[model samples]
Target: MMTVPSKLQSVNLNLWYGAFWALKGVSMAIRPQAITAIIGPSGCGKSTLLRCFNRMNDLTRSVRTDGQVLLDGQDIYASGYELTRLRKRVGMVFQRPNPFPLNVFDNVAYGPRVHGVRDRRTLERIVESSLKATALWEALQNRLDRPALALSAEQQQRLCISRLLAVEPEVLLMDEPCSALDPVATQHIEELMRELMQRYTIVIVTHNMQQAARISDETGFMLLGELVEFGTTKTIFTNPRDKRTEEYVTGRYG
Candidate 1:
């Protein structure tokens, strides 16, 4: 029998910001074409760990890391790695909807254009396809000329996701993608994630355990920068192996 490889793998990974340790000896293997949710209380390293895959933490000063994070068998932290390429392959959606001030079409087209896709027809196709993938095409198709910032919070978030898809990413890192939206909007984004899992490896950091339980194929529990438990969503929610995990999931304490 053959085994499918992990789309992203973190091995004994540790991270720090300035003098403060953020993640401690955490390891995980994110399978391809699936949704993996990382859950924990506030101040835990869930967000820190998500950023490590695409090296988003490097934007901060005095950030340091130990051990390895591999993307498709290649070590991302290896010397002479190309950041642009890595980021292009592994895209990110932030906690807030941060669409550009440009029109809807332009916002989605920005990524491909940056990657040297200059042909007008190609840019149009990419924009259309990306918006369609995120289920924003129908509503925004007639409003392509309107400013992306003018849309509702949910629309803006979906637009941000469309923007990432234009770059043709293999892995998606979502940091509380629905934290700022209403319940209705959050459900829409969750449904979109389910659709996206057909073609992408998605890793999400969320504080909402219910959201994690509903949308994730697998779930990991973190506490104080340590990964206390990781397993199937059903197992983690229904029958977690660790006492800490049970405590968090069962509403005993977070």
Candidate 2:
């Protein structure tokens, strides 16, 4: 059997927002080419832990952290770690589909352009491939010149994922990515996520237990500021060791 390598790891991670402790010694490993879902109630450190991967939590004022966030055996919080490079390597898709106010072509090309891919043909190919990877090329191929915001909500979300793919990111961090979409759109995004995991490591935070159960290989349940349990999706759902995890997974409490 082939062994899966760890793509990302968080060790004894603790975070504080002013006087509030947001994450408490949280530790887990995200495997390569797999979807790992973080599920918990609101304000339960789910999003906070997700942001720690690419250092998005640094944007928040009065936030302090102690502990290691490692990517491929390197500590991202180390002084020499480049923030821009970290973000580029570990791309993020937010709760809302936030496409730049640009045409579909430009939207997909944005990352490559920022990284200095100026040749027109190369940009075109990258745009097409990225869109194809996200399963959006057919629908938006002829409409490349149209404004991204003019597309349907699901299309916009897929476009955002395509934009991330254009950068050739190693990991994808999604924070409740389907929360803002209708049920049909949510299903579409979930399907897209499964496809994308063939190439990229995925970590998603979702409140929808059914969604997590459907899409994830591994599941982590966090509550208050602690990671209560982490295991295979089947095991976590069927036989959570922690009572808190059991309560949350069984819909007994959150």
Candidate 3:
């Protein structure tokens, strides 16, 4: 049998924020073109581990890390790796909808603009395709010049995703992308995530166990900054190997 290579990997990864250990020795292989969810109680390092994939944690002044975070078998933390390029390939969406205070077209076109694509036709095509991918083009096509912030909560989140897709990323790191939306909106975003996994490797950090179970192909359960268990969503929720994971999944304890 042929095995699918990991799109991203963490090997004995550790992280600290000003001497406070946030992520213990956590290691996992993220399969390509699948949704991998990290579920844990608050402050258990779910978001921290998700951020590590794109090196977003480096923005925090007090943060430091050790061990390897590999993208396509190459260590992303290597000295000569270009961070801008890494971020372009590994895009991230935050917990809240944070569309630039600009129009929809500008928000989706921002990344390509920064990457030095100044041609009007290229930017227009990228913006249209990205919005279409996120299912926003139909509703917002006539409103491309409208402010992104004026969109509904769900639209804003989808628009944020469109912005990431505009950059043509290979991996998408979502840190609770639906946390700010209502249940209906959350379901829409979840459906979008499911569709996106057909083309992108997605890792999501969600506090909602049900959401994790519903959308993830694989799930990782974390406790006290350590990955207590990692397995298929079915196994993790129904037959978790660790007592901690069982308790957490069953609402016995967090």
Ranking by lDDT: 3, 1, 2
RMSD of each: 1.2, 1.2, 1.0
| Candidate numbers sorted by TM-score from highest down | 3, 1, 2
Backbone clashes under 3 angstroms, per model:
0, 0, 0
Pairs that collide, model 3? none
Residues forming the 10-long window of minimal summed lDDT in candidate 3:
1-10
| Residue 14 miss distance in model 2 (angstroms) | 0.7
* Model 1 weakest 10-residue run by lDDT: 1-10
Over 91-159, each residue of candidate 2 has an lDDT whose tens digit, in order, gives 999999999999999999999999889999999999999999989998888999999999988899999
RMSD of 2: 1.2
| Model 3, backbone clash pairs (residues 3+ apart or across chains), number | 0
Cα error, candidate 2, residue 91 (Å)? 0.7
In candidate 1, stretches whose alpha carbon ends up further than 4 angstroms from where it belongs are none
Residue-by-residue lDDT tens digits, candidate 1, 1-254: 01768889999999999889889999988889999999999989999999999998999889999999999999999999999999999999999999999999999999999999999999999999999998889998999999998999999999999999999999999999999999999999999999999999999999999999999999999999999998889999999999999999998877
